[model samples]
Target: MRCSCCQKELINSLTLQELFFSSSQRCYHCEQLFSKIDQAQVCPGCGRPNSTELCQDCCLWQQELGFVMRNFSLFSYNEGFRQWIETYKFMGDYRTRGAFVLELTEALQKYQEYLICPLPLSKERFEQRGFNQVRGCLDLTKRSYELLLKRSELAPQSEKSREERLQMKQPFELNVPIEKIRNQKVLLVDDVYTTGRTLFHGAELLYKSGAETVKSLTFAR
Candidate 1:
């Protein structure tokens, strides 16, 4: 096998349990390039590492929105993560989606009862990128998901300043029937969580549409 990130030949060094149960696709060296977040030490609201309680950003969200978000993130948005995203998302290297399949699959087990919903890309963005980055990762997990939201064309989040992101208007509209969301739990999936604006907007819409609960998961924070 070859490492998904570096394309180097992989060495078979897994223990029996790992060999049987693990679905990791990257070599040790490539994997080590990214930093993992310790769930226990993270902020209760947004999963910011080393935080004991809600981070300031999350507290602000609660003050403004009347609810706090429960987000789980696996990796820190460090240099390695930025590089990976640059290649996988901006460079349109679709195959890099496999690099985190094992991590995503394991993390999602806890939300098995919740409907998985990957954030939608605007039509223009999807055409330019050729795929929805969040959905690309979710697809490799072989899990079912719903395209329950449609996005309007807008500036990409990556290009927006923190103030701009926070001020941005809601860009998502429900793409499915209200009955589909009513009384259901939803797990919103995204490639990254920046200022909490985008996810909060989606959550607000779901809550107003009668969703029982809404949580979010992102590969990076």
Candidate 2:
């Protein structure tokens, strides 16, 4: 076996249970490059690490927008994660999508009853990138997801400053019929949670469209 990120031979021995029922695409060395957030020690609101209470961004969401969203994330957006994103997303290495499948699948088990919805890339961005990074990961899980929202082309979030991101107008519109969202519990999936602006924008739309509830999950925060 080999590590997906480093492409080095994986030397760890697997237990009988692991060999029979578990799969690991990333070796311990590569895995150690990124920090996994301990769910119990994270912020109740945005899942930011080391926070016993809601983080500042979450508090702002509640006070200013009158919106509260529970976002669960698996990893921190550390240097290693940034490099992975650069290769997989920006450099168009589609195979790297499988690296986090096991972790993502485990994290997603509790949201089985909710409709999985990957946040969209604009048509222009999709053409340029060749795939939606979020959808790429979800596809490997063989999890059914709805393309419920469509995004209009704007500057990429990576190019925007935090202030610009917060001030941006809504970029998403419903892609599916209102009946699909009406009264459904939605789990918005994304690659990362930056300032929570993008997720909140999508959640606001879901609420206006009559979704029973809207929460989010991301690979990183």
Candidate 3:
């Protein structure tokens, strides 16, 4: 299969997080520490440069896609990253959630007073996938992660075409109570941003809930 990162042909790769107990980066299990950066595109995890791509999800059905927002991804969805997602996403590797959150913390700390919210999983998807990948990243941040958006079980997003995903209407709402988020910077977290329909709907929901400025942070671009 094609890599989720560079969209290049993928080759298997090993990660520090997956090594034997002796090779553990261990950092993957701890809150990610920001290594400092001059701007947004450079990844703090690997310190790699020029790492930006619109993934397969973005290439299709981009009409309602908002261009004003910015996103920061932790790593390109290369073979190794794909495996990471698989292990944590499906095999009950919930411990990996902490590492992803640490990664997100270092990336999102720059935006102050932001509300951290996870992209919702349809009831069915949540049951099938077992855990929302967005939760993995949010655990590392000091900010409060509100269950603002919700997922619909009617049709699974994975089964839909990019256009179908884009056409998906607002299915999320604020589950945590907040009087006003107006003008407050809000960060919407998600495991990945393929078509971006999820994030767009999420940003709108935050705004409707009174968020002043809305920003998105993801593990991938």
lDDT of 3 by residue, 1-221 (tens): 22222234323453444443322133322212223223455433222335454433344424344434556556565655666667778786776555444345556777767767678787877888777777755654666677766665347778989887876666775666667566667777776656556777777777677777777776754
**Rank list by TM-score:** 1, 2, 3
lDDT of 3 at 114: 74
Determine the backbone clash count of candidate 1. 0
Worst 10 residues of 1 by lDDT: 18-27
How many residue pairs clash per model? 0, 0, 10
Task: Give lDDT tens digits, candidate 1, residues 1-221.
Answer: 77876777877776788766655667887687578898889999998999978889988999999998899998999998999999899998887887887788999999989999999988988899989999988988898999878885577889999997875688888999999999999999998988888999999999989999999999999
Task: Extract clashing residue pairs from model 2.
Answer: none
Candidate 3 Cα errors over 4 Å, as ranges: 1-67, 140-142, 152-168, 176-178
List runs of model 1 lying over 4 Å from the truth: 12-23, 153-168
The segments of candidate 2 whose C-alpha lies over 4 angstroms from its true place after superposition are 6-9, 12-23, 153-168
Taken over the whole model, the C-alpha lDDT of each candidate is 0.88, 0.87, 0.58
lDDT for 41 in candidate 2 is: 93
What lDDT is obtained when candidate 3 is compared to the true structure?
0.58
Best by TM-score: 1
